[model samples]
Structure formats: structure tokens, C-alpha cells
Target: MGSYGKLVRDQIPEIITAEGREPITYIASRDEYHRRLREKLTEEVAEFLSADDAAALGELADVLEVVHALAMSLGIDSVALEELRQAKERERGGFTRRIVWTGNR
Candidate 1:
């Protein structure tokens, strides 16, 4: 059997079972769950960046789901997160301008 000790979607085990395979899984501790969720965020972001146009949206959705989990784990729900995001956007702005700075001046 292959080893993949990473966080996965809630329905993954069910999907595995539907495919005629039994998935071996266990519950992670609170700290371990937070750590794994962070790792999953990184993994999903990389996957989203590398995906082709046809699969990019799905990969991006996975990344968002991971981000949501991370926020919840940190005691910040979506509304709070969005509030923080807007505050940052108002103060520092966002990437809308597509500005590419080259070096310190």
C-alpha cells in the first residue's frame, strides 16, 4: 500500500470505499491537525498553480477549502477572515494593478 499521511477531503475515504478499496485512516490530534492543514494549504496552492486551464478552477477550489480549514483552526471564521482581508486591502491595497517592481530604489 502507498503512504500518504496528509490531510484529505472529507469524502475521500468514502470515495476509496466506493472504488472497492478499504482506506486506513486515523484521527489526528488537534496540533497535528493544524500542522497537516497548513501543509495541505501549501500542497493545494502548488497544485493549483501547476494545473492546466481545464483543471485550474478545481485545484483553486481545493486551495480555498484548505484556507478555510486553516482559518477555522486558528479561530477565525470566513467572516472574520474577510474583514481582516478587507482591512489589509484598504491599507496596503491588492494585486489589481499588476505592478511588477524590479529592485529597491
Candidate 2:
């Protein structure tokens, strides 16, 4: 039996093969992935989108997988990328506070 992560990783290539063309999978899956990512981002934006927390978490995992694939294609290590994220967080305040818009509506 494959590990859960392995099974999920295998699905990408399987999806490609089942579609019988690279573009089909890329187009379909990428759009689906983009939609889900957008939903998650929207939730974060509004601060009231926790109804699909589990689903959103899964979508986030999928997004990370896609991003990891892209980074690998471009010869980037995920760990190094994360370190860069940490560095950025150090330079800028992290997302722990809410922004208040007090200007013109």
C-alpha cells in the first residue's frame, strides 16, 4: 500500500494519463486548482470563510503540490523557498493582525 502522500502525488500523473493529453489535464486541473486557491484566498480576505476548512486545507495541499512541481521544473528546492518565506516574514510583519480600513469608503 502506498502512503497517503504518495497516493496523492501519483494522482497528478494518473490524471494526465487518463486524459490522454497533457494540455487537457493541465487546463482542467489547473483551472480547478486555481478556483480552489481563489476560494481559499477569498476566505482569507473576508475573514469569514471557515465553513470549508477541511476542503480548503485539502485545496491548499494540492496547491502546494502544484507549486512544488513548478519549482522543481525550475530547479528550486521547496525548503529553500520556505526559508525565503521565513526571511520575508522577518522583514515584514506576518499575517497575525487584522488590517483596518479607516479612510474613505
Best by TM-score: 1
Could you give candidate 2's per-residue lDDT for residues 1-105 as a string of tens digits?
121111224366767777896522233255444454455444443443343775676666556666665555456789987887899999986888887769996
Q: For model 1, how does the per-residue alpha-carbon lDDT over 1-105 read when each residue is reduced to its tens digit?
A: 113587778999999999999999898889988989988888888899999999999999998888889999999999999999999999999999999999997
**Candidate 1 structure lDDT:** 0.89
RMSD score of candidate 1 (Å): 2.3
The window of 10 residues in a row where model 2 has the poorest summed lDDT is 1-10
Q: What's model 2's overall lDDT?
A: 0.56
Quote the positional error of residue 53 for candidate 1 in Å.
1.9
Note the clash tally of each candidate.
0, 0
Residue pairs in collision within model 1: none
**Regions more than 4 Å wrong, model 1:** 1-4
Q: What are the Cα lDDT values of the candidates?
A: 0.89, 0.56
